[model samples]
Target: MIRVLAFDVFGTVVDWRSSIIGELEQFGKSQGLQRDWGAFADSWRGGYVPAMNQVRRGELPWTRLDDLHRRILDELLREAGIQADEDDVDHLNRAWHRLAPWPDAVAGLHRLKERFTITTLSNGNVSLLTEMAKRAGLPWDCVLSAEIFGHYKPDPEAYLGCADIMDVAPDELMLVAAHPSDLRAARDAGLRTAYVDRPLEWGQPGRYRVPFEADEFDSIATDLLDLADKL
Candidate 1:
């Protein structure tokens, strides 16, 4: 039985695309800036993986998620020709803090909490994750991050690291994620796996025909509520 259910926060538990797009849109409007907010959101997001990949490969010094986001945000604004004052830029850099959970996320996480210890194991920095949990009512018993491990998901260390922290055998921990790569890393590290579908995670809107990664996972669910019911 799984004693702890660790989650990938950005797409699995929270809707980052919609939340960021919405925030960018509001910021643009308030600043009288004409911008393609969605494009800006996408462009800013484009830097995330490569930034983490550099650290994963030891090409760059370890960096926290918040700093990575800020680095990308600066370039993204310049590329978009959008300008903001220092206070606004600081606020914009912190947009990750306000990410919204999917409509079913909170209720489903609540249901799962009745059965297991729910916590975050995300690439999101610790402070960022904590702020998001508070803002979105994510119901995480505690937040864990790449900041804590100095590593990102898809790395065996990051996946198995959770089990070590929770003081449980790998099999006793279940990694719940929408991303197959993240889940696959967990499985390779000896944890059980659950793939919870988040069709709108990328905000392509019906672009995904299916989100299955591999047949190795122990179970698959449409959402956390379904995963909780399965357990």
Candidate 2:
């Protein structure tokens, strides 16, 4: 039986693209800066994988997502020729904390939490996840992150560590994510996997697509609510 259901927060539970774009738009207006906020959002997010990889590969010392975001933000501002005070940059860096949940996220998580221990298993730092949960009303029993393990997703330690912390075997933990890479890693670690289809996770209909290959994941659902119903 699945005792705990772990979630990947960024694009799975919350709409990061829209949330970041919204924050950029507001910030741009205040700074009298005009630019393609969507592209800016993408540029900032584009740094995420590489930033995590640095820590994953031992190329960089253990750094929290907050620091990574600030680092990436500084680079982006310099590249874009945008000028802002340190306070402004700091506020902008926190946009991740203010992300809004997907339409079905909160209610579906509530439903699943009734029958299982629902918590985050994201690469985001614990503080970042906690703030996001509070802002989005996410009903996580507890927030777990790669920061805790000093490793990111796809690392065996991160996946198995979650089960260890929850006092459940790998098979008793189910990882729910829109990203197949994350689910695949969990499955490889002997955990059950559920793929939630968030086709617009990248902000374009055909930009990203979720495969429903029957053999790949234990289950595939259109969204969290659908996944809840299946469980």
Candidate 3:
């Protein structure tokens, strides 16, 4: 039986792309700048994995996701020749903390919470996830993150560590994620998998949807509500 449900936060539970784009647009307006904020948001998110890989490969010491995001933002700003004060930049960097949840996220989480212990299993740091949950009204029984385990998802240690910390066997913990790569890694680590589709996660129709084989995941749902039903 699945006693715990661990959610992947960024694209799955919260709509990061749209939220970031909105934040970038506000920042651009404040700076009297005109640029493709959509592309800027995409570029900022695009840097996430590579930044994490740097730590995974021992090129950098373990850094929180917030710091990684700032590093990427600094590089992007330099590349775009956009200059802003430290306070403004810091506020903008915190856009991730203020991301809005998907339409079904809060309600669906409440629904699922009735049946299982719900927590975050994300690469975001503890403070980041906590603030996000607070801002977005995400109903999490607890918050867990890469910072806690000193590893990121797709790493066996991260997956196994979640199960360990929850005091559950891998099979008893279900990893509900929108990313196939994350789900696959959890499955490989002996956890059950649930794929929640977020077709607009990249902010375009069918642009970045990952294809998966039938039966690849233990459960597949159109959204968190459907995931609750499936469970």
TM-score of each: 0.95, 0.98, 0.99
For candidate 2, the TM-score is 0.98
Q: Taking the tens digit of each residue's C-alpha lDDT, what string does model 2 give over 1-231? A: 889999999999999999999999999999998999999999899998999899889999999999999999999999999989999999999999999999999999999999999999998999999998987899899999999987899899999999999999999999999988888889999999998888887898848564546789998899999998998
Model 2, stretches more than 4 Å misplaced? Answer: 210-212
Tens digit per residue, CA lDDT, model 1, 1-231: 889999988888888899999888888888998777877887888899998899999998999988899999998888778788989988988999999998889999999998899889999989999889888888998788877777788888887778888899999999999888888889999999999888888777545435564576899999988887888
lDDT of each: 0.87, 0.92, 0.94
**Candidate topping TM-score:** 3
Q: Is candidate 1 or candidate 3 better by lDDT?
A: 3
Number of backbone clashes in candidate 2: 0
- Arranged by lDDT with the best first, the candidates are 3, 2, 1
Lowest summed-lDDT stretch of 10 residues in model 1? 205-214
Cα displacement (Å) at residue 131, model 1 = 0.6
> Which sections of candidate 3 miss by over 4 Å?
none
Give RMSD (Å) of candidate 1 vs. truth: 1.5
Model 3 agreement with the true structure over 1-231: per-residue lDDT tens digits? 999999999999999999999999999999999999999999999999999999988899999999999999999999999999999999999999999999999999999999999999999999999999988789899999989999887889998999999999999999999999999999999999999989899987777888999899999999999998988
- Least accurate 10 contiguous residues by lDDT in model 2: 205-214
